[model samples]
Target: MGLSWQQGPLGAKAVGQFLTPEPFPERLLFVEPLRRRMRVRLDGQWVADSEDVVLLHEPGRYPVAYFPREDVTGLDEESRTTNHRDLGATAWFTVLEKKHAAWQHTDLPDHAKVLEGRVAFAWRAMDAFYEEDDRIVGHAADPYHRNDIRRTSRHLVVRDGTRTIANTKRPLVLYESGFAPRWYVPRADIDTAALKHVEGETFCPYKGLASYYDIGERKRAAWSYPQAWPEVAAISGWVSFEPDVVDVFLDGRKLVLEPGQGVVSHGIDRGLDPDELQERK
Candidate 1:
């Protein structure tokens, strides 16, 4: 079992469905103060630095950090546009000729008054975003999303139709917020001959770059973190099967994909760049 959506200050469902209005039936927006020192870099220069930052949590979107206008530098007004659904008037700015690098609310609604005089940098446009010295990857980290990896002796098996792909008694169970527990099997216990390496990859901030494997025409049916982050080193070189793509069993009991585990496309991939890939090391 994973963490429930409503268990945290902000619901995990809201962050997962960031662009949908269904999760926010009340049409409410949340703004709260961020105590950490936040910084933004553009064009090889620090464009913004502030200890007093506010975070806006819009429905179906990751939290965005807004810095005090006075702390930002080298911004030129690019254009003015109406906000989405008339929330307010928005002003766009360019940082060092990077068009639409930042934006701010010029006309605030009663609910979004806290955003006044604050500017938010586009995560994809900026060279880097930081919470103090360490760089932040992907979108802003969701306060509600949590991940835990537990080592278990429970017998687990992965199969594709009648072919057994992996069988292990030592499995690592990864429990992430709003998702089902993913069982990771050790490489030694898996039949490597049954897996074919696939091209392209995906990155996870909490983990690292995930290398995919094909199981007899099942494209990307399994994934492994070859070089995982220090925090989740237990899953390094261990493979986890996509329950929806193949059959997974625990002690001979078949497992099914949970309701919220369906894959949904998101825009965070836009933030991935050569620099960001190189930063993984």
Candidate 2:
């Protein structure tokens, strides 16, 4: 969700934000009862399964699913950690000898009473997470986050310094929540010879896996959704450039990287030296 943390029902009661003086700015923290069957797997074994799950949506954060403790199994208490969250102290747990595999709120504020005794698993620590039969990718889907693709006739062009990499008259513009507009150019219009397929890939919950293209020395200058999720199938095989890495022009005007356009590198790429981009090649 694009909402701020203080805009939701428990916003005012959250420990960190609540301490601020009134008139408190509206933040958001949406907690909704999920009726669908949810399951968590670790090392190819089901660790938690529940029909009654709660989904928490915090601004700028991915949705997290909380399952009732009774439905979960095979967890051993590891240690207790003082929670800075409004939801009391936290008790950490390990699954199948995995370290810090999960945690639950030991105590909760009255406003967050619904989350009492519910456990939230670390998605990255677990082998897989499922809503029903299909595996959920990336982070949990944000119910409030949405993506829209619109066909546009505006001329678009991408360049790596003086080398023109792509040019197109028909472009697809994707409008996604909490992100700036991304223009996708037709593959036929791109200089295919200049694109070098990169080794790494990224995933999106709304969209499917993305393949990157290296423009000479500039790594990941452009990317394409080879097999996009059904919701955003229109952008499948269409190339989109990273505005911060390359020059993009629309309708004869040069485009500038707007605020929030930077992609936060995560996983193994996080905290590495900037020069590591060359090693990834």
Candidate 3:
């Protein structure tokens, strides 16, 4: 019979026969070239440059790569650890292992699969902390979720003087629990002549780098940071847009979402969060 459960040394689930897990090598190189002296801290101990650091790619799990003994910042002989087999490989590393309920994939109900025509892929949001439950639980679109960032696209149609004009527009959505939703639009989608660069950039371990753009007459309209995590780099050209804050058009009409005063901005919310482990766990 096929393997039913593959548990790590510390009792976390490792791999299952039917699960779809990718190798860590599949990630994109860091936008700023990867540093040679890479060391990560695990619960206050340092695990340094050793040849055993192994990198693995995991979806939904943060820190896409799994570092071996040498790559960690704080790991030493004093750390009480165990080594064991979980299916085929030796599950190593003490401070880093998969967390419970953080990794589980059960087959979908057979009938639910038949009603939707055909589903190419099944996607779940990264961890509720990155995207909280108060906002949206999860959604499926096209073939991939990319970096777990939410996105919606529409073509703009407008009435110009006596003539009607049609323009294609795309917008990105960024939301946290109990916070206001922010929309970002591209210069091409809107009237770019009025938008100016704000001179700021932010980094997400899942999405990559982001630069800011502000609406000349309004505030920040759209921004794009070309470099992103290698796994879902396909959405690199896409920019985030604010739906309510900006007078941007979605398809033929302006999008009118329910005005919410309790929108949280951004941060890791553990109370309404999901499991995120950057290590072997």
Most accurate candidate by lDDT = 1
lDDT of 2 at 111: 83
lDDT of 2 by residue, 1-281 (tens): 23322222333333233555665545455788877898988867899999999997765456789999999988999865768355668989988888897888887888888889899988888877778976665556556567899999999988888988988989999987666689998889999998899988764556766789888988888899886878898998999998778889998888877754445434422223323322322
What's the candidate order when arranged by decreasing TM-score?
A: 1, 2, 3
Mind sharing the TM-score for model 3? 0.35
What is the per-residue lDDT of model 3 for residues 1-281, given as tens digits with 9 covering 90 to 100? 00111121111232322234854332222111122333322233332333232222223222222223223332212222233122121212222331221111123244222211111111121222111112222221111122334666755432222332224445555452222444544446544444467865543334445666665444554556465445544446555544444554555566544433321123432222323211201
- lDDT tens string, model 1, 1-281? 12123322244453344466555454456777888898988768999999999877665456788999999998999855658553578989989999888998898877677788999998889877888888877766656566789989999999899988999999999987656689999999999999899987777766777889999978889999887877787898999998778889999999887664664323334445645654656
Which segments of model 3 are wrong by more than 4 Å?
Answer: 1-153, 157-166, 169-190, 256-281
The 10-residue segment of model 1 with minimum total lDDT is: 1-10
Instruction: Point out the higher-scoring one by TM-score: 2 or 3.
Output: 2
Which residue pairs does candidate 2 place in steric collision? 4-28, 5-27, 5-28, 6-27, 6-28, 7-27, 7-28, 8-27, 8-28
The TM-score values for the models, in the order shown, are: 0.86, 0.82, 0.35
> Residue 215, candidate 3: how far off, in angstroms?
1.0
Scored by lDDT, model 1 comes in at 0.77
